[model samples]
Target: MQVLVCGGTGCTSSASHQLREALRREIKARGLSSRVRVFKTGCFGFCKLGPLVVVYPGQILYCRVGVPDVREMVERHFAGGKVVERLLYREPATGEKKLRLHDVHFFQAQQRVALRHCGLINPEDVTEYIACGGYFALADVLLHQTPAQVIETVKKSGLRGRGGGGFPTGKKWEMAAAAPGAEKYVVCNADEGDPGAFMDRSILEGDPHSVLEAMAIAGYAIGAAEGYIYVRAEYPIAVERLERAIRQAREQGLLGRRLFNTGFDFDIDLRLGAGAFVCGEETALLRSATGQRGEPRPRPPYPAQCGLWGKPTLLNNVETYANVPAIISRGADWFASMGTENSKGTKVFSLAGKIMNTGLIEVPMGTTLRTIVFNIGGGIPHGRKFKAVQTGGPSGGCIPEAGLDTPVDYDSLRRIGSMMGSGGLIVMDESDCMVDIAKFYLQFSQDESCGQCTPCRVGVKRMTEILERITEGKGEMSDLDELADLAREVKDASLCGLGQTAPNPVLSTLQYFRDEYEAHIRDKRCPAGVCRALLDYVIDEEKCVSCGLCAKNCVARAINGEKKGRPYFIDRQKCLKCGVCAAHCPQEAIYTA
Candidate 1:
């Protein structure tokens, strides 16, 4: 019996280390150490009920298993063949114990491709990776296929780059290979800077070998002997795992010279980014990797033509590279069969916000937003109405509830004025104010803006100021028109993808929820009551029993009344609108308007 304990970052933070140790101790105590092999593996993706433990051969999944449960698991399940009923995942609605990961609704529709080996193998063990067919693609590419043939196969796969921009992967490799340069380089853009995004980080932590193998394949396809993985310094776990994987691959002759006896030499080096958002851009990343200031330069001298020390370079993000080995192993038709006509295969999304289940999910390209939210995500929490879903993070747009039935594909989302940006899906409930949401995204973009170009620097500032004014109820009718004009100007004049898509949230909100904006501007009233400056707190005299709860909870001494037997009144001037009085009122007398 092999017991696999989740060793992913999320589980690790929740004391999965202690659980692993307890399991080992229990196995030794019961004299089952020889029979039961306890090992630590990567994320199981059912993070809402982690730290998870799965016993192999039977695949009995146990959710929320702590250190105390180890002894029972070793004795009863491992020795007596009796499953732990209490630790198994119970369906929230059906009250059924979900034994396998696939049996759970959260993972029912998921098609794990880029995340293929993520929850299955022990990332630190190269032997486990090899056992799970890790470097077979690289071995096959090196021994049998030419560089041109490899590029042709990728082109046939219809695999567009998964890093925001939907550029063809094969064309990028072909350009770098055909470029007139003796020295070329392959770069893995792991500096994922988008908010609410951890897909790349999860992949790096869970299956570092997949990325290593993919990078080696990219090096071979693009005629590059050396590769650089530009990962952010903030992702310490991912960086550490990637470093360890690289060292292990080198020792095992998978990364160093003459890999797999094909004489196709390739090696990877880690480059730590200083947590700059602009460094996510291809040109800026190239500059940073070369020991220079991270900044974007003009294209046409694109990364394919001149990159990383002025030679041909091929750059692809972590998710895009994660798809490479699978495409080569499973064939292009297999991948292309999964998604829509244009967009092929599954896309991973970090599902966040008001959704009941907030975690990472990989669904097919054509999966509808309705299915993602209602079926897979288990709907919004607190019985609230679905308001909108924001995809693409800061660079993408908000999709309203009315568009829930729309199919989620690259072209469909783009057609609706939103792009499939690195797949950050933030669900919103009815309580979320559209104007406030727009302002929040604008603020994030402005703060993350590199200020390299005048358009992004100045245009985003003006746009943000207008949004702030609108949210604060100081906006005019003219500000709406000005916002649109500025958004277009920035999109046209910006140098890179960041500035170009900075106005997405503003434009999307305006397109979908114009009524909220009009209400804030015309009546000086925030429809959702989220803008504190536009709202006031008042006491409902009928509901107030003079319990003095509100009076006692008022920090500013704003509530004035006789202790327990008289009517309570609020001093408006003294009230700070902190909502403490409202929150603490036992009779629910206080209300905000």
Candidate 2:
């Protein structure tokens, strides 16, 4: 029997390494080493239940496993053939134990494609990748089909780039191939800088070989002999795994020079990025990859026409390339049949913020947001209502409850005033202030702005200042019109996508949650009580028991009350709006008005 342990970064941080070692020691102690094998694999997507462990023969999925639980798991499951019911996942609503991984609600609606081999195979082992038909697409293209035929197949598949901009992948390859240059380059953009997004990082960590194999296929199709993966240095796990996968593929004659003895010569090298959010853009990424400043230039001579030292280059992000092999091996019609007419394939998303199941998920392209949130995500935690889901990272916009039933495709999201930005779906609950949320995203965009352009550097800063004034209860009603007008200007005048999309949050919030903004500006109050400057702390006299904890903990010394007598009153002038008194109140007497 084989035991698979989640070795992804999330599970690894939760002591999955120690658990694996403990399981090994226990199995050896019980003389079951020959029968029971333990292997460290990739992420299982159910990150909330990690460190996850799965035993074969019955596919018993164990959740939140620690080193201490290894012995009981080994002895009960391996020795006595009894299942460990305590470690199995219990359905949140029904409280029924689910022995298999897919039996849980979190995994029910997911249709894994880009993440196909992830969590299933050992990434470091090339044979495992090959066993799953990893490089067969490249081989098939090399032996049977010509470059034109391959490009035609990809075009017919309706495969679009999954890295924010949904550009046609086949059209990109066809352009690179048709460009007037014999020396072309293929680049895999792995600079995943989106907040709360880990889809690319997880794919790289769990299935590094998939990316490598797909890159080789792209190289063959585009007539590119060299490739570079511009990944950020922040992802050390993904970097290390890619390094190992490249070395393994080279050693096995899968990466370097003639593959299947074809005349095509291709190889890939890694270029580490300095964590610049702008580098996610194609032109900016090419600049960084060529050892230049990571800033985007005007794109009339787009990357396809002249890129990377004036040679035609083909670039696609990690998730986009991960789907290439599947499309090539299993006909374009099969992939085309899955999603809507425009977007045909599955899209992987990182579910974060206020959701019960905070993990990785891949649903078909046209799957509604309501299905993703309620069916697969298991809805909001603590019975809180879902306020909105922010898609496409900071550059994307928020979709309110009224838009929850909208299908999540590139065109659908764009039509709703949002874009699919690298697949970051951050769910917000009622506690999240929409105005504050807009401010937070704008602030991130402003800070990460390359500052090479005037519109993004100065315009976004101005928009951010307006948001600051409104949130601080010092804003005028006319500032609302200024904010909207400035957002449009910055979006139109910005040089690159960073500046172009920086105002998305501001514009989208103004469209959907105008009342929240009005409350902050006109009423001088934070409806969600999230903006500290707009909050007025009050002591609930009925609940206050003179516990004195609030008074003792107040650093501002704003609370006034006798130790055992009347309830404490706050001096608004002296209060710093730190919320310390409210946090320390034992009876929950403190509230924000």
Best model number under lDDT: 2
> Positional deviation of 97 in candidate 2, in angstroms?
1.4
Q: lDDT of each prediction vs. the true structure? A: 0.89, 0.92
TM-score of each: 0.97, 0.99
The residue-by-residue lDDT of candidate 1 on 1-593, one tens digit each, is 78888888788888998999988888888888888888878777776678988888867889888888887887789999989899988877678888876778888888999988887888888999999888999999999999999999899888888889989898988998999977999999999988888889889989999999999999998788999999999888899899999999999999989999877899999999998888888999999998999888889798899999998999999999999999998898898898989888899888888887777789889899999988888898788999999988889999998889889888999988898988888999989998999888888888888888999999999999998898788999999999999999999999998899999999999999998999999999988878888888998888989988888988899899887677799998888878899889888888887
Tens digit per residue, CA lDDT, model 2, 323-362: 9999999999999999899999999999999998889999
TM-score of 1: 0.97
Quickly count the clashes in candidate 2.
1
